[model samples]
Target chain A: MRTLILLTTLLIGACSAGPQPIRYGEDACNYCKMTIVDQQHSAEAVTLKGKVYKFDAIECLVHYVSPLDETTFSHLLVANYDNPGVLIDAKTSSYLISPNLPSPMGAFLNAFDDANRSSAVQREMSGELHNWQSLKRTITTRNQIPN
Target chain B: MSRGLSLILFFFLVSISTSVGNKLHVGQDKPYATIHSALAAATAGDQIIVHSGVYRECPVHINKSITLTGYGMPVLDAEGEKEGFIIEADSVTLEGFEIRNTGFSYIEDRAGIRVKRKHISSFRTTDYITLFFGIYLEHAKSGIVRNNALHGKPLGEANSGNSIHLWYCADIDIEGNLIRGHRDGIYFEFATECRIRQNISEGNLRYGLHFMFSNDDIYTGNTFRDNGAGVAVMFSRRIHMLNNLFHLNWGQAAYGLLLKEIYDAEIRENIFQKNTIGIFTEGSNRINYVDNDFLNNGWAVKVAGGCEKNKFHWK
Candidate 1:
């Protein structure tokens, strides 16, 4: 259930994030707002100007991105929620998965651009070391969690 | 005051009464050939009596107030091709009829009966009641649809439909009915001031009762069993639910009741058994959850943040 909530949050963030950074609510960050990276409300945003903003949690990005008009955006970008500085398109970002993550929000990085980097991250997180398709299949099937 | 004057007055009264045009008998000299034909010629305050048979036809459109009753059980079939009945009229009563085989379309929302009321500013805009719904009311006021059975089989989400669907209606009374095997047993939206009582809703693919953006509706003494989810109340205010039973609604993402963005409501004395969650309340506020029994559910209540001042009594 907790994992589901986190996926729902991520889905919301993904849907709301667009090309231009929308000023969401009282805070900054079009996708998510992050005063810092390690906190609960950290988020990430990608603007139309090819600049990407990273936050501590998904909620910060949602505050701005959720209310933005869907037609006004040009591109979507997100820092691999796991590996900062390695940015990727939100649609193509395969590593951030829904279920079977160590985090409370149930988001985990499954693969990186480099196979060695992915293997290292998998070892650190004690993951099953699945490929991208396997990871997506696992996340999609994880609709329910043991309470 | 004399006998001669009294006799004249009696004749005058009889003449006036004959011109009132109230009673219409079916199977008489001008007996209505079909239910649709009789409905076409009838006026307000008139009665239409039908003989027993199956009428495999399209939806009959009614726009005047009248009472339509069947002598024996009369059947109206959409042939699973078209919608069943549409009532744009007010004060309509349909009794002793079986409506079946409504058209299934994922794109169009169709049902057995559809009622549409006049706007608020229209002349003679009075509230009505839908006592039973093998009856659907849309944008109608004060509809009373009662004492009927609605049955349909749903293949999937795309092919499923609601047995009774009301949109933008108010002051509804749904009572004493058996509704089963549809997508939603009942669906209401943007409606208010309604009461659903003493009904059995089962085997639906979605919810037994689902409504959104509606307020001040009371649901009591209804049985919802073997549905995908028992009930869902969303974006509504000031509603009250009492004495209903939600049972055997168990699946992934299923719950006895799902509440979202609701305010100032009361949920009391309902029984929830064997559901994924007895009640899942998210973004709900100021709700009084009183004396409800939750038996063998995955969770009695799963509450999220943004819920405040919700009181749960002993159960």
Candidate 2:
């Protein structure tokens, strides 16, 4: 009976060790306190142990993750701008910083599926294009309180 | 004696003329075809009366101290595209207008009526509410937004905007407004000494009323129902929340009132009924919860860790 219980616990834990769908409209952003409603701009991060933190916007995801240790997070994902609610891998996701596209937090940031997709909007809106690394750095530096 | 009598009558008439403001009428076949023309021709202490007509005039910028009154509850339609009015003047009176179709924008926080002045930038850091508001007031003082109905089709999943939003404003009276279908029914950030009374805020996506980083504010006799969260008071101190009704706000994150990091506040005589959580507190201190009725709630008061010096008393 003991071995059977241990086996069941392990099975349940393993099965739960994956990304969960963010409960939109119902779930509050763990960082900014807004409800995760805009599927087009929502973001989420999964820890290695399967704990998930959802955010209302992509910048909120970045703002939340910036102060934390990176090794704890296993998956970083953002909602695809074109697809709307479809979470894409954040490491390779393309970003657009444009005055025309105002994010929920007024950051003027949007995430796309690829570089080409971000570039397409940049062509007309005249914005700077960025990737995961550059966008994180830009947001971090820009939001840093000046002395 | 006749000259003296004429001079006394002339002085009396001058006092009456000074007390009453000039009234400018706006409607079809009137002196001004659009509200913009009337506003331009109007002076300080003048009243603009708009007749009952659908005016598709968004972005109505009011830069002078004047009374913009609607005679028969005129409709100022944004046509689901632009903002309705941006009032930048002090001591402005906006009354009896039905503002409609404040459109959506991820970039801009559009609204039905927006009053603002240049605000200190650090105030933005203390804000808990999100963008895109219905009636937005920023850095404004001594203004009155009363007896207005704002109808919006707000998005449910995320923040569409607050029905009435105040930022860095002081001594403003937001009263008797029916606000529906927005992210937050009413939101305040860095606002002080404001009086919010007798407002019906329902069908909102997020909190019916939310304020943060604001101090010495008062909210009374308001009804908040069918919201994601009834009211969220965060990072604020010295507030008076009295005689408010919060009901039927059902959700995982919903609460009749959610208090976080608040201090030195008095919540009195409020009825919290049929809510998922009557009151949830975290990191809050020095609060007096008195004479409040908590009825049929899932958790009457869910006290998280780090709360201190809290008193709860009820009949």
Q: Using DockQ as the measure, which candidate wins? A: 2
Deviation of model 2 at B153, angstroms: 1.8
Query: Looking at model 2, what is the TM-score of chain A?
Result: 0.88
TM-score of 1: 0.63
lDDT values, one for every candidate: 0.64, 0.79
Q: B163-194 in candidate 2: lDDT tens per residue?
A: 78887688877788787777778888778888
List the candidate 2 regions with Cα displacement exceeding 4 Å: A1-18, A31-34, A38-42, A57-68, A78-147, B1-20, B118-132, B155-159
DockQ-based CAPRI category assigned to the predicted complex of candidate 2: acceptable
A12-115 in candidate 1: lDDT tens per residue?
Answer: 77766444432221122322111122222234555544445554333233334555653343553444534533445544443433233422122443334455
TM-score of each: 0.63, 0.77
lDDT of 1 by residue, B108-196 (tens): 45666677765321112111111223456667776666766676665433245567777768777888878887667888776788889
Q: What lDDT score goes with residue A37 in model 1? A: 20
What's the number of clashes in each of the models? 27, 4
Considering every candidate listed, which one attains the maximal lDDT?
2
